[model samples]
Target: MNPMIRSTRLALAALLLTALAGCGDKTSPQTASSRAPSLSTVVVKPETAHREQVWDGVVEAVNEVTLTAQTNARVLELPYDVGDTVAKGDVLVRFTDIEQKSVRRAAQAQIASAQANFRNAEAQYKRIAEVFSKGLVARSDLDQARMQRDAAQAALHAARAQYSEAGQQVDYTVIRAPYAGIITHRYVHVGEAVQAGPPSPQPLIGLESLKDLRVTVQVPQSAVDAIRNHHHAEIMLGDGKRLAASKVIVFPYADPKTHTFNVRLLLDGSHASLYPGMTVKVAFAVGAAQRLLVPVAALWHQGEMTGVYVVQGDSVRLMQVRVGERFGSRVEVVSGLAPNQHVATDPAAAARYLSSERAEPKA
Candidate 1:
């Protein structure tokens, strides 16, 4: 081969090798610090954190019942509807009481007859006893009079009981509130036929006492001891407001199936719309100690895994974290984060950076 031709071929191969090496260096993945992307950061300031175990719970009424019909009757009158507040003994529903009233009147008449017979028997027995003692009447006559008086007294007693029962029947016709409560639902209107108990004639009304409210939390058995010994606790509303629990009632036994104990916490009476069935959060005091805190927005959620981007001197790394009870906009770092470290405030931006870094070409 010619010397000039061989030299040209070698020179061309060297240039191609150089270009490939340069391209590889340009496309290779690099650390975040190498790019030095500008990012908003938050300085971690550890505060006196309250360590609590938060459990999702629901607001419940202290007294709630679906008032049922006591006797099969057509609803004669419905005085209240849903959302009506009623006091104890307030008539909520009135049924036709014609039969009950008639029975009561008959019982009253029987009482009247029994009383008259009893009086006559008493007077006769007294007269016979006196005469018998004076030897003016035979002993058999006295015995007969005594038996008649006793029979009259027994009749009177029966009559009284029948009358009382009849009165109750009449009273049952008028359904009244057992306690002061707000009517949440009314299942019957006037003229609706309501059946008697057991297969309780479709509930007449649903009543609940909201003034006396409580939170029932089914706590895991593992946290039973903590709840039992809970020195202090607070309930967090959906809006992030915290209110202290008036009392805590930890049930002694745990459910066999779920292995959870019922923990009842009473709420302070409020006129607000903190209604029953609202989902709330309960934070039972496990312990009180200082810990790192971060804004909830700073925490990145990756499926089930949660993390935060810790930025140190322009170098950012995704750090896994365990978050505890939320405090306003911030949350307690249970672990994986330290005090005085800066983290990206915008988790979305941090996540984007992480994604980009991952998308870089691999050697």
Candidate 2:
């Protein structure tokens, strides 16, 4: 009749039962919440499929140049400044032309002197020839006249060449836009000296055509083949607007440092927002085939894993999916998915709608 011993034995038995129950339902809090739907569901279906790869792109001018002085001269007149739009052959900047002008003038004077001397020599040569034919003058005198005439002709040719070269030097003083474009930057100010050569010492201005635009991407080695082999591409603007690429160019060589190939996507026409140096996205269709698709909003991420919530009959299953290219609002499922499955649009909200118990079957 040990009453205290009997009470202690009952408490130990209850404790053991509780421990066993807890061990059987070993689920983490995060896992438990993820298994249930917090919101509504979406049904996914097979779509006319295309695989897309998005790459970071930067907008660039189709025709861009850094304007620099062609000769060593002081900047005299800079008619255009930063942001000024200019037409082809429109004078952009002017350097000092005093020396060039002087050279031109001197050459012109020399040409005039040569012409006058040539006129006198021609008249003397004609007179001397007549005298020689008549035997009234020595043969030596006629030869002397002929030599002077030839010398005058040579001098005239030299003077003309010098003048032509001087004229070119004068033209170099005035800088003009080669094509219609906007001046993005002005590197040289008034009175600044600039040198011109193969390696320009300083850039005078930055000119870029706003009307014609393109985007450049350093595509990784993986995507280069698909893009180079006649795949479709589109430029995605920051506001979510998509424009089909008019031209696609893949650089023949990959950069040694980055090991990525350069790709240029030429846009169709002038866009107000698309300009040089602006960041954008480019989508390339790497492959094409029929595949299941669901709205991008349906996808959820947990660390490195991406998944979606799916409804299977009376029960909901949180699934892991392998995804490919983004097609507007929807994304393609490469694996871990089957056609005609119900997918939740928002996994977080959908989780709140489901419980540990299976959903009831509908009529």
lDDT of 1 by residue, 218-254 (tens): 8899988866775566888666557778888888898
TM-score versus the correct structure, for each prediction: 0.63, 0.63
lDDT of 2 by residue, 62-116 (tens): 8899876767789988898788889999988889988889999999999999999
Score residue 256 of candidate 2 by CA lDDT.
94
Look at candidate 1 and give me any clashing residue pairs.
Answer: none
- Top candidate when judged by lDDT against the true structure: 1
Candidate 2, residue 248: the lDDT equals 88
**Model 2 off-target regions past 4 Å?**
1-49, 135-140, 195-202, 291-363
Worst 10 residues of 2 by lDDT: 21-30
User: What total of clashing residue pairs does each candidate reach?
Assistant: 0, 13
